[model samples]
Target: MASFHLVSLGCAKNLVDSELMLGSLLAADHRLVDTPAQADILIINTCGFIQPAVEEAIEEILALVAVKNEFPEKKIAVVGCLVQRYRDDLVAELPEVDLFVGTEGTAGFADLLAKMIRGENPGRLVLPERSLMDSTLPRVLTTPPFRAWLKITEGCDNHCSYCMIPSIRGPLRSRPVNDLLQEAVRLAAGGVKELSLIAQDSSAYGRDLAGADLPTLLQALLAETDIPWLRLLYLYPSGITPLLLELIAGNRRIVPYLDIPMQHVSDPVLAAMNRHYRRRELESLIAVSRQVLPDVALRTTFLVGFPGEDEEQFLAIEDFMRQHRLDHVGVFAYANEEGCAAQGLAGQVPAEEAIRRRDHLLNVQAELAAARQRQYLGRTLEVLVEGVSAETDLLLEGRSRYQAPDVDGCVYINDGTANPGDLVQVRITDSQVYDLVGEIVPDVGLAKEKNTARG
Candidate 1:
């Protein structure tokens, strides 16, 4: 049994692919190692969504190739979107990489790895069908036992001019509801308390499928799994129907959190990026969400300095942010990846100006996030314990429905005796720009009962 080390990069969706690869390797009796130096085979899952990501992936791969030189027997494999995007180029440029597997070729990972180790050619490129894998596929959970990401769909349909996802991952392909339910059941059975639903565009799920949609899928998942938290990420604004909002409002397990990637609020920018929704539509969507679910924590991402983005367009986004007071906001300066439609677009914004715009938006959001957190002060909210705080062992860190793992802030529990998966009520004591300080509410039932008695 050969030992191997795998490095997974990119979004949660890509991480799912990496986990599946790990599961395949384990099934093939390959041993997983902690470091590249200790492994006989090394795998690097690359991301090529944008220029910065591509650079990072290349740098990491070069570092691993250097490690391979020290131990000549170590086999190297480069897989995922980066390889899919630049297969021939990478093969010729990086001869040290024994195998170059694309996004669709991950299913045959075990066989490919085995063939390469035995001095057999595993083919320079393997591009299979552009579809999602089934629940029956082997998948080792790489996340904490308490939380797991459920990819309900694969690829994307929306050809956002700036995004390379459609070209890299292919068109939208929604997994069957039955298959997803079985996986969710397994995850819940395996003690996963939080199930985060992910996809390139989750709101676009079921568009290609017959008699299906995201709300219906959520209903099935809620009915079947006992997972405490079911959160949705990467939901495009276009497909967020009223039924979806109603479903979220009705279910307690379905967290009152939405990650809508409203790239820009200006009409001209939206039209330029082919976002499909205008500024008025966006405002209406936010207004309806606030009306339907008052406590809903709205999270959104913005793409600043896109081609043709001007000072007026930039200020419009700031104005929209001020008007909405969104709970969480992420800003990224656009990068013109080759092959994307935006690459050839006129009026390309300079890299330095993009950086300035991104910084300005972030500064504004910092103040907004701090103010939004203050609203929760003196109130009790349910938080899922993550683990010991990175700042100090004395303090434990966890996330409320408002906070997504890694991207959003955390709730620091000052004094709490609870396991990682335990869902406990916490009383907010202090607030920061992003995080909140809270203490686990002792005798939660009793506190509620006392309040009832007082009422």
Candidate 2:
């Protein structure tokens, strides 16, 4: 069996694709290695959503190429979003690569590589196909055993002015409800405790299909799967119906967390960005969510420094942030991609000015996040242990419902004996700008019983 090393760089959605590709390789008797130098084949699954990601992909490809130069026999395969976006066009730039696969035909990658290794020279193979997923497809999980990501849809329909998703990923294509349910059953049977549903626009799931919708799918998963925690990511604002919120509120299995990507809060900015909802609609959504689920963690992302974004529009976002005091906030500066509509828009924000705006919003969020965490102090929130702390082995870290893996803060279990994936109650002791310090409550029933005595 040929040994291979795969490096996946991108969002969790991209990671799923990498997993799919790995499954194909493994099925074809290709062994996966831990390091690029230790393998006969090196695979780089790259992200090309924006300019920064494209640059990162290029850096990774060049770095791998440098490694390949030392071992002339070692072959490098560059695949995923970057290759898909540009197709065979990357042939001129990175001629050192042995293979170039795109977003589609992931399952057929092994056959192509076999042909090339025999000197057939498969060249650049960016076919018009898909590796979105299949219920029966064999996949090797790259994430922690207890957690997995379920991509419910492929591509995107929302042609946001500043986004390259629709162009690169194509139109929205929701997976059949039965297909997702079967996949979820497999994940649950395989010991996955937390399953995060992901898509370019998660709330838009089933709109392009027959008989399936977000709430209906959630109800089925709740009834069928044993996965303890179900979370949704990348929910567009307008599609977040009250029915969806109510279903989430009614189910303890569906953790009280929502990742609503409200790019901006100014009417003109929203219109320009092609976001369907206006500022008032966003306010109404938040209001209804607060009323329906008081303890829900509302996580949102903001894009600062869009074209024609003046001080007034920027200040409006700051004002909205102050008023909402959202549980979690991610701020990003807009990128002017080659084909994006915003690239041609008048009154472009300077690169330095964009960075400044991004920094300003981050500072605001830091203060707000710190304050929001303080509210959790003394409260015993359920946390999923995520193994040893990256900072120190003396500590264990986990995440509460409020904190999504990687993107948000974590709860540091200072004095606890728990395995990864164990759901334990933790009493918060301290709060930072992003993280929280806590002690595992050790059997929530026991902890609650002793709360008065401990006090």
Maximum-TM-score candidate: 1
- Per-candidate Cα lDDT values, in order, are 0.89, 0.87
Shift in Å, residue 440, candidate 2: 1.5
Question: Could you estimate the TM-score for every candidate?
Answer: 0.97, 0.96
| lDDT tens digits by residue: candidate 2, 167-276 | 77788888888989999999999889889999999999999888889999999998888677899999999999999888887777788899999999999999999999
- Superposition TM-score, candidate 1 onto the true structure: 0.97
Model 1 alpha-carbon miss at residue 29, Å: 0.8
Runs in model 1 lying further than 4 Å from the true structure: 443-455
